[model samples]
Target: MYFTDRGIEELTARRGDESVTLEWVSDQLRTFVDLHPEFETPVERLASWLARLDDDELDDE
Candidate 1:
């Protein structure tokens, strides 16, 4: 999911209050997959990383 700036802002707003919806998570994961086409590791690793909230979790962050 290639998020437009609006999409990203919407997601950030939803996540900020710790009220994350499944849709937001799904969108973010899809965005990651779209951004990193050369990912060699398992998708599970990616999923695991996506499930986390740590500051150092995502490379783009």
Candidate 2:
């Protein structure tokens, strides 16, 4: 498994039952970027991917 999977698993385990809005997630991402500029690119990519997820699924139909 990828090393990043550990963090993903932890996130799932810790917050799996919580429901959050995209706005909140976006705010958190921005806050994270503010604290860790070095992760800006990956975070940007992740945000873009998330923003396009529904459109991407539409393409499969």
For model 1, how does the per-residue alpha-carbon lDDT over 2-56 read when each residue is reduced to its tens digit? 6577877896888667876778777876777778856635555757775775756
Weakest 10 consecutive residues, lDDT, candidate 1?
A: 37-46
Maximum-lDDT candidate:
2
Query: How accurate locally, in lDDT, is each candidate?
Result: 0.69, 0.94
Candidate 2 segments exceeding 4 Å error = 56-61
Model 1 clashing residue pairs (backbone): 1-30
Give each model a TM-score.
Answer: 0.37, 0.87
The lowest-lDDT stretch of 10 consecutive residues in candidate 2 is 52-61
TM-score of 1: 0.37
Q: Give one digit per residue, the lDDT tens place, for model 2 in 1-61.
A: 9999999999999999999999999999999999999999999999988788779674886
The deviation in Å at residue 38 for candidate 2 is 0.6
Which portions of model 1 miss their true places by more than 4 Å?
1-17, 44-61
